[model samples]
Target chain A: MKDQKIVIIDYDAGNIQSVKYALERLGITPIVSKEEEVIRNADKVIFPGVGEAAWAMNSLRKNGLDLLIPQLTQPVLGICLGMQLMCESSEESNTKGLGIFPLEVKRFTNERKVPHMGWNQLEKLNGALFKGVVAMEFAYFVHSYYVPVSEDTLASCNYILDFSASLQKNNFYACQFHPEKSGAVGVQILKNFINL
Target chain B: MLSKRIIPCLDVKDGRTVKGVNFVDLRDAGDAVELAAYYAEQGADELVFLDITATHEKRKTLVELVQKVAKELNIPFTVGGGISTPEDVGVLLNAGADKVSINSSAVRNPNLISELASRFGSQCVVVAVDARFAAGKWEVYLNGGRLATGIDLFDWILEAERLGAGEILFTSMNHDGTKNGFANETLAKLSEMVNIPIIASGGAGNREHFADTFIEGKADAALAASVFHFKEIEIPSLKNYLKSKNIPVRI
Candidate 1:
């Protein structure tokens, strides 16, 4: 349980170093790699991204990660755009995702702010990803697109409306928020992922 | 519901915290990273590091400081002060700064805003505008509020949003040093005119000032420096006070 081989997929996306820093805070120096074998051999894989959808997908495809991510069987965690890319499709750039989770991402309507940037609490928490997390704990979020509440929603947050804050299906877990930048609540989620 | 953010502003000079912080637990009080970690532990929603160094080595020092802050702190932080080009923003963001705030640079070359938004998503671009009420109207100021650009506050914010600025940080020079309250009237007007989030800065002396900003000013976030750094208002207690006012804050 202590020596889990964790690797964070690095595909030239924004803020990948912050993910490495977050894992280092957990006392695990995660390997940042785009190599197929290095990612395949890891006990836990973390896929993180912060950029436009179609552009990010292009980077993933360039590194052959678009095809390899869906085949992984490890306890994988995806953050922000990484999670969106795992879905069936995204309204952003009208791009198709990797289809790991049967969901879709859409742009936030003008009813509220576009980036939904700030701290928001998680509701209806479930699964090991939320272990030891208090009810309605706040986590940092910064994004314009969101995954609507659906079948795989492990946790939900309300902004313009109820959206999927986190999704879980089999070993694949994804969050629309930046767990690395979410302070303690985020740290707990990462620890839970490592422990699982 | 998305809670209103409480951000603390830290002034950095020569890779160190310039404004004196009052946290007793810190071993080295001058270190920017230590102070940033302290603020995070105390429940600060987010942090803004304003670099005050004005030398050629400023970038290298600021980048190292940003790297340290990201590695040590878990909460999101924005790096400001003297950011002008896409290269500057790219270096800071790559070093782990969540967002970069541009001021005079954007005013000088308006195209920079569109360039930054296209290169690194609008979510990470924050345009900080310093303004004051003069001649019966709000005029934008530049170079730390030393020079007035004669740019209308309302018009500038509208232009910034259209150019894809995710958030607007407005500091009322009139209310800044006064510490009486925020520029609620102007803030409310700016918030209404723009679709992006408005972060109200200047004149935060008490907890009620924060609540007022959220209510009357209609700001999405309130930022303060001396109040949090000088320890006049602790983040946890301030958050509790805001929560009591039914201002929807994360405690």
Candidate 2:
């Protein structure tokens, strides 16, 4: 079979380079753009971001790509803020997400620390991203908001709470952790996404 | 649980990696990209590139080298040496560096840490300080350990954290390249003084030293050079040993 083309939705999000660089390592030169036709024509899509969820969603809506995203039939992946934005709503910056997954993104309570940085174990798996990986394998995470664990959750990680590490519904897959920074386990996850 | 990280420090001079003992006796090692890739595959959580050659004529060349490494390596890469202002942070970030380590400049202008952190976020700013056991205390050093800044190491570390540094890369000049062990007492003290992750550098000769740095020194990460470069301790084996010692590490 011919290699599948993955399109990374780029609306000036900060993590574009890291995602693109990771994809490139897997022999996939992801086309980073907001062009409707390119995204619609691609075999797969990757929504990557690192910033305030509201601002990022606004950027996506301003470019008219936010509306086009839910319509994609191909497997769509979201990272960090991308994952949070795929939910029903976000407490971070009072953002409304795509609602692909029946989940809510909420800010970390002050009882612990904000911006739960560093590596954490990802338990529970129900998505292609965890295919062929051991349970509770460590993944690099750097986020302050999390999607509360729900029936749609594909994996769970705990920092301040046991929340969804990744969520999947239909052809959509999203991870709160940064696969680009998670080393080999992250590389395998990206590879699984490409295969999917 | 995440594994404690083992990082290999590369001193780049004029776009090439060079190693020395006690910050002198500089000798050629290998290309930065090749070594970084090797270390990454060997299970290094990250790699730190210190532009030991940040002299006037070598600054631009080192930046170019960083871009090259950033392009080829998949692991998180940090660059340090002569970063002074927020603009320098921008230049390195734009060149694809994952993090920028600030030392002398941070001590000179404490606000530079906040400026860089505010602009790029704390995760991007790593405050580094080289210290030596002087006058019954650790003193911060600058200019590759040639000059002393007279800043108390503990006070400077706390100040960096307050200024929004995400991580602190503390190197002990007295133990650097000595291959005896880390300044465990000093590291333990500093580790207690801050909440941000601390990367212990200098004086790593074997696998046990890495565990000691993490366990006894209470460092979040351990960094070395000669041992890794000379094949004294491979990254994977050291991590396995650390794992056996009940220290969390990515294997």
Candidate 3:
């Protein structure tokens, strides 16, 4: 397992360092790269991000990384804005995403909260991410926009409404929460992603 | 639903955790990294490391300590004190701090808040307001509560929030070190005025103080120093108390 290569796609988004540190804590030195070949040849890839949707999308498009991302055959994991970028489109800046999942990222409304920041419980867990993790385990989240629960939703959390906490479709997996910031349970999720 | 947060704040000076009463009478508490890992294991939702070191050389040492602690724990950690610029914030964030807190510098240059938020995102920026009631008004203080700014407490918090501060750490100087309880009335008012999360800091002597801060003060989180530093209140037991009071706390 130590010999397996893990690449963290550097789209110049936020929280990339924390994700790298989290992986390092698990004894895997992940390569932070934007180069096409390095990302393409990795055993596993983590597409982690934080920040405004439009700015991030523009950066990805500028580097032509947007075109390269969808073509990766390896297991890819997206976090927060990275997950939103994987969708069909987002209300934030009205930008289009990778369309890996037929989902829409919308700004949270209905007067509940804007960012929906803090730790919240996950329910209806499915897929390899929650293989040994229990139902209703808490994970740290900080985001204003969220991907609504859809067919690709693997885990759901209710903030203003039931939203996708974790999403999965084929080899691509994503989480709206910052699992790197979450405690021990988060380590398990990262471990599962590595194993997958 | 988001659970209420219990944050254990460690005052780090010269690479060691220090306990100071009302920002005076400093005494060594323990090692920062060890104390932080203990708090994380004790059910502390998050940790705040206030680098009280005044010199540039010691500040660098604190940054090194942050890297060491970040490697030892998994919970979110916030670093504050002596962080004046976006580059300073960048240093700590790169050192593995989840957030950087600014107090005096943000007051001196209000634009710093927006600059940091734009560069690192608002989620990584925390604006701490150390306030004290004087002459029938709550006024802001700076330089570790040695000087008072004429800015109104509520007004400054609202302004900081508008300027892209993700959260506010409101410490009531009048209630600090008293152990009577948090300034619930003032905290509740501040909570009503701001849309972002407010962390109630300063006076937290027992478990009930935590509950009062959450239920009455309406704060999103409670931060304390002496109580936890002296072991008067264990984080796990305090969390259990909060849970029993029907307050949602991570355990």
Alpha-carbon RMSD to native, per candidate: 1.2, 3.6, 2.7
| Evaluation by DockQ, superior candidate among 1 and 3 | 1
Of 1 and 3, the candidate ranking higher by TM-score: 1
Residues A40-76 of candidate 3 have per-residue lDDT tens digits of 9999999988888888999899888999999989999
Q: Give the range of the ten consecutive residues with the poorest summed lDDT in model 2 chain B.
A: B20-29
Residue range B1-251, candidate 1, lDDT tens digits: 79999999999988999866776777887889889888888988899999999896767999999999999989989999999999999999999999999999999998899999988989889999999897798899999999988899888889999998989999999999788999999899888888899999999999999999999999999999988877899889999998899999988
Lowest summed lDDT window (length 10), candidate 3 chain A: A108-117
Model 2, range B1-251, lDDT digits (tens) per residue?
64577888888889887764232222324677877777788888788898877367778887788778876777788898888888787777767787889888888899999988766777778898899887797888987788987888888888898998888999999999899999888888887877677889989987888888888998888888888777778777887888899998777
In angstroms, the error of model 1 at B159 is 0.8
Give per-residue lDDT, candidate 3, residue B186: 92
True contacts kept of each: 0.90, 0.24, 0.49
Models sorted by lDDT, best on top? 1, 3, 2
In order of TM-score, best first, we have 1, 3, 2
The CAPRI category of model 3 is medium
Off by over 4 Å in 2: A1-3, A52-58, A88-99, A106-115, B20-29, B55-60
Q: What is the TM-score of each candidate against the true structure?
A: 0.98, 0.88, 0.96
Candidate 1, residues A82-174, lDDT tens digits: the string is 999999999999999999998879999989877898999999999999999987998888888889999899999998899999999998999
lDDT of 2 by residue, A1-196 (tens): 1377888898975657777777777777778889999999999899987766777888888999878999999999999888888888988767789888877788778564345766789898776778888988888887777888898888998776799998888899998888887888888888888888
Scoring the B chain of model 1 against the true B chain gives a TM-score of: 0.98
